[model samples]
Target: MSQTPRYQEIRDDLLARMCDGTYPPGSLLPAEPELAEAYGVSRPTLRQAIQLLADAGYVEKRRRRGTVVRRRKVEQRFMDALMSYGADVEAQGAIPATRVLQARIQGASPEVAEALGIGEGDPVASLMRLRYLDEEPAVLLRTWVPTSVFPGLLGHDFEREGLYDVFAESGLPVETVRRVLEAALPDPVEAELLAIDEGQPCFLFKSVGRAKTGQAVEYSVALYRGDVNTFTVTLTTED
Candidate 1:
């Protein structure tokens, strides 16, 4: 029988070591020359193995840091239930903080009106927020609510309280939300706001949230950093 490819063999061994905690997250692996020598493979073969790990989000190569294992990606189960971004990060043992970038009342645009089931030119409370996980900028969020549903929402302190909490306190909780997720390259403005390179890939989430009575009450557009964030949805099929 033919032998397993050298690169694949090396890659599998490294993955096993990582899984067994030999290569802990945020820890640097041995230098390429050392690894190549230890594995009895050429430098190119070792690099090919490491490249596979990098592509799978297992490690990152830095200029001065060599190859370091990456922390697990944050998973946002948007389909399972309504969850605050803060809660999701906190559940992963990371600090969650919010910065209120902008809040004001504005006339609804055509798209916003359609999403919120309001007429064009009607007043809406517009909120722009930046979310941070462990002090790293993670998501930029823009949400609009019909002024008729939650008057004076702009007066609340969004930086300290989550939007969902604010809405629930005002008797306008979002019972159901419909979301459309798409892969996008960030614009210059988004790149600056998210502290990422221009044209970096991001996940764009456009959602319409409905009240328990089935009234569309909120429309939001959120951009999440693709590097550190991942979305998971569970699917089931009966045999």
Candidate 2:
């Protein structure tokens, strides 16, 4: 007897339909009761298949819109050179935009302080930005830099300017960035801003950037939508 579950069979069919344009990107799937009846399966079974699709980046459950097919995922290849997000997205032919949600001086938390080699509670220039790809919310960035290093960091218009360019122009360019990546879930507010469910998966990135003088210059945490984004890293066997 075939051990494959019925839901798995249904999921495969749905995926095939998506590939053939039977269910194009941004289109909503049929209502659960209607689809379940069409497939001769229980609602629970149908949902199981749908949930698998969501987890695999094939579809997403939108509030009041039901399940929606997703467009092609964004491919981010800047990690190898630690390039700016804007440049990377533009290289891939996608429109990039950033909105500065908050830009001000704030006390550095323990993690930020350690990354910046400063005392906890010391003043740091904090910036919270929402990044968009093709006008769709993609990543959230929260950054901290020591005030002594860049006192006028908050005076610039970040929405229209790029941070890397500003840092270089200020004579404190980011020479190196050490980062860590992990899979995680977003908080309620983060979910709303990303237009995704709170239970949806996310990629969390934490990094510390340093100048050529080996001085820590910036620390940041970034959250990326798992369903619509992907990352690539180039590895070599050279010392």
In terms of lDDT, the best-performing candidate is 2
| Per-residue lDDT of model 1, residues 58-99, tens digit only | 988766458977766788877678998878878888788999
lDDT values for all models: 0.88, 0.90
Per-residue lDDT tens digits for candidate 2, residues 183-236, read 989999999888788888999999889999999988999999997789889889
The number of residue pairs in model 2 that clash at the backbone is 0
lDDT of 1 at 34: 100
Clashing pairs in 2: none
> How do all models score by TM-score?
0.74, 0.79
Supply candidate 1's per-residue lDDT for 55.
Answer: 94
Backbone-clash count (model 1): 0
Supply candidate 2's per-residue lDDT for 114. Answer: 89
Model 2 regions more than 4 Å off? 1-58, 62-65
